[model samples]
Target: MFIEHPSQALNSLFRDKPYQGVNPEEAKFLFIGLDANYEAQIDAKPIFAKLREYHKDGAAFWRSHQVHHPFLLPQYSGDGRFYHRSFARIGFTPEHANQVSFIELLHLPTVGRSSLVPADLNEEHLSKLSQIVLAGTAQHIFVPQAVARLMHATGRFAWLLKRPSEQFGPLGILYRQQAKTVYSHLHFSVYGKFEARKINEATAIRSLISAGI
Candidate 1:
């Protein structure tokens, strides 16, 4: 399951008065996404440190892993080869790397310095790259596509199609179309007023378990 903030959220889940129906032990995997440049923020250090600790523990406990967009990682050329290597270092087996059960980080380039929206990239190119990422990291690839198509057919894509700056929600919907079925129990905490608070990891995990991920 995707745990937006497994560290803090987990604590909250374990501490909140009455126990809920969720069982944490049932979680076999945890996928985490972190902002690479989070350390730059003076106030974000403590939270980031906690997240790193949680990441290490989760990786050991559930063989969990992480995926970061190019913008989040250190300086590196935006090349497919670089991505392949990065994925390997994150513990993706060669075979798994070519399948749909793995996690992926999608990156988009902005057109100008003042722009918050991403550049209008070629859809075909994005699709091709997305296909590669899915094939290498997914176990149930068809489900995500089906979800996206269903959403698209029903006009849900209309809302998702808006640029990040234009809409406060759906910033990560593109990746939703490529997740494996097992990872469908995923949710992203984008930069917005509503999600202003950093995600608490434990809480996210409990929520996922409750949701039957």
Candidate 2:
């Protein structure tokens, strides 16, 4: 498996740019989803599927990949190169995924639209994922629309959503006290077959920064 989760300290999983406009060293928010689908494949494996020992959380192997492509912002007409330049005009760097902590609700791989996970996804799996998700100091968090609701329904991670969050129709804001993290839900997708709201920089950044992260 050709993975970039090198033991190289600077290029460690935590420092790897796994999303657009994310720089873990500088950003204070995290945007998580089901998994990644875009990037130069290794032996035809989705970047997230190539698990390496260096990955602190194999379930989140997507973070181990250097993601420079705009896999989430399809509304940009797949023209992030020029669209992101406008973001630079506003003083926010674009196409960097280091700052935004990257993780996935399911540390599994989506093959041709089929998401495959461990046959037996038990508490242990969730526990490991929870640890990785909480370990980050990022104050702002964004999860796919169904992720937060499912986490809330699971009766797990109540500690992360101890406070009543504000629900805005299809969106909501979950709060945790330990790090004062705010979790926002969004519908993100780049697949033409799947209809989902495209992720936007303005909304995501504003929510993250306004959360006081």
Candidate 3:
């Protein structure tokens, strides 16, 4: 189900917050998602309340979340949970994970793929997202395909849809000029196989980052 908005408590608490992660301005990589995710049994209110308390410190936020969040658990480079596996495939080491930042286009934690669509974003939300992205200093930006498409359609992030791009498997590389940072358009789950060929898109993305492309 699509949530028009999170609970009043959550909205009021984090209305002004735009991103998550440690030292976003200094981080080398950014992993952007649609929103926070939680299972049916999880109560978002208290979870987010704690999240807000640790908002000022990304490291603490992540460390605390590791206690109950399965996604934060360690995984090897392949054949594990999709979330951490994709992280590994993208060249994100455990230490490197702390070095990167993760931002969500929307607030509220939900189970499964989010039902929140692009049209749900109002002008205020769009402005905040644009400002956050344009101001961030991360050299490598990884944006999910759905979020990228949403931004493109809204014209808030059309710069990512420009040329000087390359398509590798399911990933589309959109080179940004600001500080030579690159925006990678990737699968929503960040894991997929190219139907036309046998290529691991996440690994390809990591290779691109390694090649300094």
Candidates ranked, most accurate by TM-score first: 3, 2, 1
Q: What clash count does candidate 1 reach? A: 24
Residues forming the 10-long window of minimal summed lDDT in candidate 2:
1-10
> For candidate 1, lDDT tens digit of each residue in 146-171?
23443344332343332122211221
| Highest-TM-score candidate | 3
Runs off by more than 4 Å, candidate 2: 1-27, 38-67, 70-97, 115-122, 133-135, 160-164, 167-171, 190-201, 207-212
TM-score for predicted model 3 compared with the true structure: 0.66
Off by over 4 Å in 3: 4-18, 44-56, 60-70, 74-81, 111-113, 162-164, 167-170, 188-199, 207-213
Task: Note the residue pairs that clash in candidate 2.
Answer: 21-96, 22-96, 22-97, 22-98, 22-99, 23-98, 23-99, 24-98, 24-99
**Which stretches of model 1 miss by more than 4 angstroms?**
1-119, 139-179, 182-192, 196-213
lDDT of 2: 0.43
RMSD of candidate 3 to the truth, in angstroms, is 5.4
